[model samples]
Target: MWKGLIKTNRQKEFFKKAERIAEEACKHLTKTDREASFSYETLKVIKDVKYPSMSLAKSEGGEGLSLYELLLMQEKIAEGDGAAALSIGWHMGIMMELSQEQLWDKAAYDRLVKQVVTDQKVVNRAATEPATGSPTRGGVPETKAVKQGDQYRLNGRKSFTSMAEHLDFYIVSAYVEDKDTVGWFLIDRHQAGLSIDKTWDTLGMRGTASDDLVMNDVKVNEGDLVELKSEGKPNAKGWLLHIPACYLGIAVAARNDAIAFAKDFQPNSLNTPIAEVAHIQDKIGEMEWKLMQAHSFLYSTAKKWDEEPEQRGLMGSELAAVKLAVTNTANEVVDLAMRIAGGRGLSKKYPFEKYYRDVRAGLHNPPMDDAVIAMLAKQAISKD
Candidate 1:
């Protein structure tokens, strides 16, 4: 817990609120982020409790949490539901960049931030295309944003959009209007011609509603082009990896779940709790140990960025290292969680199945481990 977050006679109440949110989320831990379904009740709890606004500056109606502390907050919530953690993470992570860069008209930023905190809206980045691939791989978008009178017409098929269906607005990527530039347009989902093409069938993050965003000439005003660039490095936007932090939180959550389960969950033949089993205890111990090491590497790097705000954008080496380390741990921790669940883990009724699929998403995320290793090797050899 970061110092001074909830300072009042209400410290007990705050923890109670926090615990209640975790409890509510725990009820749906098995739901697929792809569930992409809306829950007014759940969303209301999040807004009232204020986790979406966790990263927002207190001065700007946010919690004023530092990046490192925000990461910790994300970890705590994710221990309950990985998808909700990420759905919220995507919004906060984007806001951090907008604030850092001072993009958009002040009014829009203000309204957007408020909506995020209030649960009135959600924003996501749409950057993938069928012909190309992930925006991560330097794939240029076939999606075109054409400038028209008083507006821009955007046409594209974007895949792998996180939280696509539920978004109120999307900062969609396309070849710049009649140019070779990469452009990002902030188109509202309510605008005509923007539609969710299909429900995503991803194995993980199912509750996130990670769906395909389709635009067959969506119209947008100049206000929509929040960012435009003729040329730049693909990795210039480093804030994207804040998402990995959310995934890391999921691992932490699974670790906690396993430990608590071990305390009382008894197998058919076991007269006592599984905590008494040496092998089970060892598995739990090793997972905790791995989490500590992973945090040591991750937290230090995050703190370095916060303590020195000048460092922004992704360094292939550092970001890759963070992604590789945390994601792998998430996979392992979740596996141990499933193993602890025994045969029950494989069933849909068990949250372990959902956690298993969700954790795998980390491994596939870019910068893929191989890419990171190769880049690190190059950097090491070159520097040496």
Candidate 2:
């Protein structure tokens, strides 16, 4: 197992801490999902552990952990509670990106990192506009950031702003009037003209608090603008592995539940538990097979990204393939687990229904299945 590969004592300690925190988070997941509310308690636990700062530089008040370690921690958190993992994953990813790329202005970025380290501030990129859909689709954002004398007035609405109410900062993407280019502006939650509509009623991931963010001329400093490279090509980001890790954790939870239920569940007519049933065993085996395949791909890609930084530039296709495979397999595993549990899976008494819904959300995450396939095809054809 990858855990055995963790040689350093610091890494092992961090992994143990993550496991403990995840267990605590799992205790509240039922109530968290039932209310369809953000898991503030879980967030508090994560904050107490300072998990968000795991990826920042040691000089920047972080543990200076590798990307692989961060993904492992995220998977553990997702096993306990998928919503909490998804919400915190944004903060961790953003911090990691800022730590490595230094894309944002130094002073502003430093301040944000300080806030994350000291106050446990939560932040996420609010880039998905209602008109533009996913930014990956290359739609021009309608969100405008008009330049003032020393500030930019940001105006427009953003959708799927996960952890909306709990965020201290939002890395908002908007069309800049002066540059005629789309850029990211860091906006604080307390800033005037910024409000959440609480319109996040969704089929799954209800606890993500993915509400609509309405910005009515929100004001931010000129320095708040994050600089972008002239080239528009997307860079390989290992942080995205957190997405697949979350779904895989949820699938693991579902599989464990199904196995336990099967071992104990006995029908009135049947002399043995459902574990003795061939059909039930078949479903469990299938789920295990899918999980193993997904885990191998996810960890191997993460390890490669960590060990071979120079090769990251050419990993776009491989990264997309991992995301597609892991997410799709997670959904399949959860479905099989549900099947093993029979009608109980559909009942509110079990967690399979929630896992099913949450795992499906991964299909809509970045590197959409259709786009991944197209990219793979383009790469293959070009090579030939």
Best by TM-score: 2
What lDDT tens digits, residue by residue, belong to model 2 across residues 1-384? 243446677878887877877888788877767676787777787788888777899998998878788878888778888888888898898899889988777898888998888887888999998889999898888999888899999899999999898899999989898999888888889999999987887888888889999999798988888764356677888888899999998999899899999999999989999999999999988987888888889988988998999999989889889999999999999999989988889998888899999989999999899999998898889999
lDDT for 66 in candidate 2 is 85
lDDT of prediction 1: 0.72
Look at candidate 2 and tell me the lDDT of residue 332: 92
| Index of the highest-lDDT prediction | 2
What is the per-residue lDDT of model 1 for residues 149-192, given as tens digits with 9 covering 90 to 100? 87889888888777676677888898875656888888777899
Q: Estimate the TM-score for candidate 1.
A: 0.86
RMSD (Cα, Å) for all candidates, in order, is 3.5, 1.6
Q: What TM-score would you give candidate 2 relative to the actual structure?
A: 0.96
